[model samples]
Target: MKIVFLIAAMMATGLIDSAVAAPKSSKQRCEIVKKKIRDIESRMRAGYSASQGIRLEQRLRELKKDRYRYCR
Candidate 1:
């Protein structure tokens, strides 16, 4: 009961916002993917723990695949 109430309150306050606003244009979508790829690459260059590295590498591959789809 308390947990449910807390979750509702958090969502109402936007503290746990999970909405994913996809880009409305192909150009914008491609740009977003490129930006995300850049960000993840930067984080990798900055260094990460083994588990985090694995996750980031996997995400990078997914982003690259999407980049091909969106950019061309």
Candidate 2:
């Protein structure tokens, strides 16, 4: 009975730790991506070439799509 109780307590602790360490929610991830997009746009406006800006925009779109698909 003592061993069983000890095992149960250990399991419960493990579960609590796992929950605490879980990744951020989808909304949080989306906000981070949005911020990144804005930062990229600002950098582009600061003198990056048109081609570079286009490439960065494409990458940002891809990142947003990926985040939307996986973060949720």
Candidate 3:
């Protein structure tokens, strides 16, 4: 009962905002993927461990795949 009241109060006060998102345009998706790749590259250059770099590269590949699927 207390938890329910607390949650209701929080929502009324706008302490927890709902996530309302619009679909991304192709350009926006491409830019986001490019930014993520650049971030991974920068982190690699900044001395991320080999394993961490590899994982980032894997994530980059996945992002690229998403870009190809959705942006192109």
Candidate 4:
């Protein structure tokens, strides 16, 4: 039980750490953002359910914001 809890805590913190980590270079970051934008656009074209479309649109907006901030 104690070991399981310890592992769970470590996994939780690891996820937080990875999520907070940034790309090593601006070019790489911009490329990643661009690729994500393309992927999202393709998925949008392929068609999603209404709820999934809303979520993807929100994420695309956030990615576009990041691209504006970093890619330009």
Tens digits of per-residue lDDT for model 1 on 1-72?
998996795455333434788689888989978877887888789898998688778888988998999999
Model 4: pairs clashing at backbone N, Cα or C within 3 Å: none
Give me the runs in candidate 1 sitting further than 4 Å from their true place: 1-18
Residue-level lDDT tens digits of model 2 in 1-72: 997885685345321122344347767666656666566666667786677667667866776785777557
- C-alpha TM-scores of all predictions: 0.72, 0.48, 0.56, 0.69
Span of 10 residues, lowest total lDDT, candidate 1: 9-18
Better-scoring candidate (lDDT), 2 or 3: 3
Candidate 2 minimal-lDDT segment of 10 residues: 13-22
By lDDT, is 3 or 4 better? 4
Question: Where does candidate 1 clash, by residue pair?
Answer: none
Top candidate by TM-score: 1
For residue 15, model 2's alpha carbon misses the true position, in angstroms, by 35
TM-score of 3: 0.56
By lDDT rank, best first, the candidates go 1, 4, 3, 2
lDDT string for model 4 (15-58, tens) is: 11234568898788889788778878887898979986887788
- What lDDT score belongs to each candidate, Candidate 1 first? 0.77, 0.60, 0.65, 0.74
Candidates ranked by TM-score: 1, 4, 3, 2
